[model samples]
Target chain A: MSGQQSTTSTSIGSRLLDWSLRGYVVLVFVFIFAPILFSVVFSFNSARFPTIPLESFTLHWYQTIWNDPDVWTAVRNSLIVSVCTALIATLLGFCTAYTDYRYNFRFKSAYLALVLLPPTIPLIIMALAMLAWFSKIGASGQLWSIIIAHSVLTAPFAMAIIRLRLNQMDRDLESAAWNLGASEWRTMREVIVPFCKPAIVSALFLTAAVSFDEFAISWFVSGLNKTVPVLILEIVQGNIDPQVNAIGTFVFLVSMTLVIVAQIFFTFRAGKSFS
Target chain B: MARTNFSGFATTWRMPIIVWQVLFFLGPLLFMIAMSFFLVKNYRMVEAFELKNWEKMLTRGYFWDSYILTFWLASLTTAVTSLLAFPASFALAFKVSPSVRRWALFFLIIPFFTSYLVRIFSWYVILAESGVVNALLAHIGLGPYTMLNTKFGTLVGYMTLTLPLVVVLQTFALANIDRNLVQAAHNLGCSPARAIYAVIVPLAKTGLIVAALFCFILSFGDFVSPYYLGGSKPPTLPILIIDTTKSGQQWPRAAVVAVVMMLTLISIAFAALALAYRKRASR
Candidate 1:
């Protein structure tokens, strides 16, 4: 009788614990996602303010932004910078990771640590430094300035991701090629490049997304030309434009897609299928 | 010939990265430090070294107030996020299946990739006078109370921004902890809650510290949320620096503020590291 009573109590207690855990997870999900959903929903509202009265839905906001030439110019600027940043960051990151992995050079650890430094430093501090450095060099507010800043910001991430893939690769494959009388350049072209391709692709997407969304540095360095985030900041500060919501929604979608693509590439590169 | 060529290639491979880091990474930081020591004459940086900028900034009540406010806000945000994330992370690490956990993590990080500005704007709209929160309050016959342009609003924004990172980091930390220790505590007649406090949290201390530091650094230096949601109050350190440099054209003072901010962050990070190291050593 005592055993039966204890078993029943234990079962009830465990069930209560399980329910509470589920509830906590659900609450956290809501907290994280409610604002995003609210914004996305209101982006289609015809009403000016995001407050709801079950208003009629329209695509006017998105249409307005699409037609805005200023926004288009900003988009172009952002794309140019993002692409350049991605390319530069990926190249530098790949070279760094490749060298660090293949050789035992002096101060290798210190060199890698320096590469990772930018991300840990505050964005405001870095932005300030870049602004000071750029103006001193007579290149303040230039696209090249923004590109360099963003590249420095993102290269560490690219290096870390690519280095993970490199570490996973079979070291024996390179040695086997060398032992088989293959030239170093030939072995790299045939073996290492192919092996590290997925990592490189993912790094491109990740860095592009980071550069695209970067605002603090771009705001400081873009002089007369504004990136998308800087433009959106202006819109928010000026008139609380509902049309900005449309731009925000679109940018959000694109950034989300880029990140998802990067993740998919990473998981595939890591030999882990979603299933 | 092949051996020499391979070695040369290996040696030269680091050249591009080295040049890139020196020119951009290390250069900017060094330049900023140098500029902070100079005086701004006629709104331009003068080459002459002076302690006036540092002395003037240190003397200002506003400077110290902004630092204090930023530190307080960051601490509050970090504490709240750590509290809320602890349970959620626990659930993610243990209660959920591996497949579900992966998707849950993906979901957690997806929102982070979206424009942070947009997310803040969404909160702004929701917290506005006639916005959703107030509307819901009216339905319940309660206050149409102010949320926007206040400390509460800024705190909300910071918490929302930092929560994902905290949760994700803590989840990984909890996942790495040995389950056997918790189970042993349970077998020793400790309650689940007690076991969590006694065993799990101690094991997850390093991750928790790292997450808290990340939260503090990101929130303390953030310019957007405090600018938008802080209403009329003196802005955070980042905003102060930006206004000083951009509008006031006080480059020296701005550089001084930036340097001070960086030093504060570095010290906090080092303190956390030292504490973690000490704990490990004793263990």
Candidate 2:
């Protein structure tokens, strides 16, 4: 009888623990995702005040965001910066990574560390330094200034990713191509580039995303021309518009799509590589 | 002939990379360090070196208070994030199926994709007086707490931004743990808690430390959360730097603060890297 009683109590305790753990997981999930869900819901809120109960669902806010010239300008600026940054960073990164992988050089580790340094430093410091540098050279607040700043900040990430890809590549293929009377450029273009294409693509998308979302460096370097983040800041500071929610929703959707696409590409490439 | 070919190819590519690094990376850093030593008089950086900016920045009571506040907030955020992430990571790593883990990983990536500012703004809507939390509080017959522009608000903002990173890193760490060790512990007649504590924890120590370091650095360097949420009492160091720069365009003061922050951050990173290396070497 005593054994039965003890077993019953032990089972109860275990059940309670299991329930508590489940509850903990649910609570954490809610905490992490609630704001995103809230943002999505409030975007459709017909009420002028974002904090108020939803009076009705309407597409008015979305229309407003679509029609806003400032929003378009910000988006345009973001795209231009991202595209330019992506191209420059990827090219530079490819060159650097290729050089590093193919050669045994002095201060290799130091060079790698140097590439990683900007990411390590506080963004504000980089922004301020760029601002000072640009001002001294009479190039502050220009679009080119922002582009250069973004490239400098993002090239390291591109290099790291591409270098990882390069390290894993079969060097024998390149040597064989070279032995087959292929020029160095031909070997790189035909043999190496195709192999490193996936990482290169990943680096491109990642750099674009990073440059698009960059605020601190953009904030300093963008003198007259504001990026989306800076524009969002201005709007928020000025007024809490339902339109801001619309804009936020749009950004969230676009960014989500980009990330999903990138992940799909990454996973597909990763699987292919593994197989 | 082969060696010379490789060397020739390397020389052609190497110079440009070197030039790029010197001009873009090292050059800016050296310039910033130099600016930190100069005197800024009447909104211009004077050529003469002066220690006044450093002394002023270091000696200010406000600077010390901000530093303390920033450190406390960062520590708090790291602790809270770790607490929330560890179990979720464990479940994802051990309990969930691979398909479910993939989905969970996708969900984890969502927060990162959203614009950072938008994420912060979303919190404002949730925590404001008229926000959902206060509405729920009111429904429960409790006082409606205004969370915006408060320290608590700042903490919440920081946690939301950084928790995903913690979860992802911890998941990566937990996934890498050897399964046989867990079974071995179980076969040895150890309780589940003891098995985890003795076997799994030791194996995951490096990952956990890395996650902690990542969280700490991210939180420490972040200025946006404090700016949007931290109201009248104290601002984070980055905000302070911005305010100082805006007032007089004091390059020296700004540079000093930047240098101090850089040194502190570098030291922390070095220490963490050393710990990681030591951990790896031990294995």
Instruction: Give the top-scoring candidate (lDDT).
Output: 1
Per-residue lDDT tens digits of candidate 1, residues A54-113? Answer: 489999998899899999999999999999998999988988888888888678888888
Please list the C-alpha lDDT of all candidates, in the order they appear.
0.87, 0.79
Residues A1-275 of candidate 2 have per-residue lDDT tens digits of 24456579766875676567656667767888887778888999987666655678889998987888988999999889988998888888888888888877789888777766677677888888888778767888888888888888888878887888877777788899989999887888898888888878878887887788788888877987998888887788776777778888877777676566666655568446522
Worst 10 residues of 2 chain B by lDDT: B274-283
Give the runs in model 2 whose Cα sits over 4 Å from its true position.
A1-26, A273-275, B1-5, B11-17, B277-283
Clashing pairs in 1: A141-A221
Fnat of candidates, each listed: 0.72, 0.44
The DockQ values of the predictions, listed in order, are 0.73, 0.50
